[model samples]
Target: MALEDVPRLGCGRSIDEVWAGIDQPPTGHEEHCQYCQTARTRLQRLQEATVALRESDLHDPELKPRPGLTRAIMDVARAEVRRGNRLLVRTTDHGTIEISEQALDSLIRIAATAIPGIHSRRCRIDIRTLPNSPHETTSTARAPRLVINFRVAAAAGIDIPKTVDALRQKIRTAIPAGIGIDAGTINITVEDLYDV
Candidate 1:
């Protein structure tokens, strides 16, 4: 079953809601609800494992993560943060300029937030270089392309379709010229719903 459709307890509480209230004394539903019981068992095991892991990390130097692991992880993270999202913009006065993916993400976030009922949570911009098919032996000109994906948490009781269309319009207008993506390809997903 989907998470939203999971059977709640008699008190209309889900496993997650109860999990959040972990510090509180257990209620009748928590004891009787099969979902809650199962969740509690899993959580208890996880808690034990976490304690064990931390203790081992403190006491056993051999069990610790390898040296340079932090540097390696940071390197990969920096590479990901720097790569594939730069937008080549056509500038009239100053020739050509490249806008970083981070800038594009910020632009998307701003545009999305301008829509009354939607707030952007995250924005990702992907710029790809077109590759030639295997059948074509001769090399083709590398044409750059762009795709935008954004997730939003929207207020309840709004028309989602209309919201998406308006969001698309806003992004199209805000994007600087020369990012080769058509408006139709810019994707928007309302990944969450919240009460305001």
Candidate 2:
């Protein structure tokens, strides 16, 4: 069948079949023949770039998030997403990306950190504080509610629960607003009730 007559892969043929069909020597039909060559070259380049990107190292700080790196990674991710793959967009610059689960986590943490009253270094999100903890007694009107644990070296006599509540509010506000992600849930557990 003429290249034009052949069913397009996307428009459904297996990759092997497509490759085999294209590899067959072009017939004398100039129009379809040229189209086949162009399609082959384009697909080859895309495959080459995909392999190159897969082997790329994005772990080193110097290379981890270089400008435009995220966009490059996102380009591939978007392609996959369009192909029915569910993937997260970690970073993007003009459209490319470098998908890294660690990077996404860091982004989320940074978003949480940006909240006012949240000490970036000292505070953490999703920590589990037991119901009977020291701070639970302040509001004993009902079942002890969980807290978003923010470990801080706070001064003695400071109300840990109160401080955590304020931090939680800041995190909730900053996360969606600053990073555009839903602030899922915050359960602050104060591990280091420091003397600060």
Candidate 3:
């Protein structure tokens, strides 16, 4: 067989089948095929390394979660949220500031979740502005018009329409001024009615 073909025999067989004899009873194929011989030698070395690792792990002391691990993870996540690209909320004659998409979504979730009897699952945000709609000639784009979709479940025994209306009002108050959203634009899907 060519030098390249030695590796092809192990392709279809599992490593367990090829290395069955190592640290165990001998298999008969080791004497016949040069490919199997070469593969067997390499597999023996890997098996030795793995056994050493397992023995070391067994001898080591038990590992426990670090103190304040949850707080450290949350701090990292908050920093990542702040570092995201902030959308252009609007531009003024003096200067401008921005907010990240992640932060915006978080606020929307907070607004929807705050309503009594409502449990919000997910939310999506969309922004669009017409091309050549006179904002092009302007220095900055228009305050981006947005559409928000909310998925939620209402608690049993609560009036559905009232709950939805309350949600709409809360969201309206939650959103900043000059942003174009309304009861019509706030799409709420009632997924289920849950007790307690």
Candidate 4:
């Protein structure tokens, strides 16, 4: 018989049901049912394995979340509630280049983290478009200029101004290199200090 046609257990209790109540003391019926005993044993082993994996991930530095992870998550959540904003990079007769705010925020975070002893925090990007001239065509209209406001935490004993300068340079380079657009004005704020 096909797997779908077979009953989950001889006692008619599914493995899922047994697993859900695994923490509680087994009922009288479970004590007498071989299927319940077997399912419970297997599920206990699975739970043990899951716990072990979580511990491993915690100890692994590479698996640790980046500095701005919480901010990034909140940004995504807000974007979901209100549709994500997109920036126009360039416009041509053939097509236009655009990048989502979420994507650009992620890129900026990546650039900030590249500098040692720096942890990214909140990042916000603003765009201002110059009014089109009467003679300017759609393809010829100027692209919007971007302003980036970024917050970060610096490690103790690090030179704040020098490190921030490096961070600004990195973002300027990364923006144009990663996506074909210039980073107009970058403002970096050192909000807090963290131990190494």
Name the lDDT of candidate 2: 0.50
Model 4 TM-score, all chains together? 0.56
Tens-place lDDT digits, model 1, residues 107-162: 67777778988988877777665655655433223344667788888889999899
How accurate locally, in lDDT, is each candidate? 0.73, 0.50, 0.70, 0.87
Runs of candidate 3 with Cα error greater than 4 angstroms are 1-64, 94-96, 132-141, 177-184
**TM-score against truth, every candidate:** 0.45, 0.30, 0.53, 0.56
lDDT of 1 at 168: 86
Better of 1 and 4 by TM-score: 4
Q: Pick the TM-score winner.
A: 4
Candidate 4 worst ten-residue window by lDDT: 132-141
The Cα error of candidate 2 at residue 178, in Å, is 1.5
**Any runs in candidate 1 off by more than 4 Å, and if so which?**
1-96, 131-143, 177-184
* lDDT, model 4: 0.87
How do the residues 1-196 of candidate 4 rate in per-residue lDDT, one tens digit apiece? 7756644888898777888888899989889899899888888999899899999898988996898999999998987855678877676767877778889999999998789999999989998778878776565468678899999999999999999999999999999898767889999999999998
- Per-residue error for 42 in candidate 3, Å, reads 42
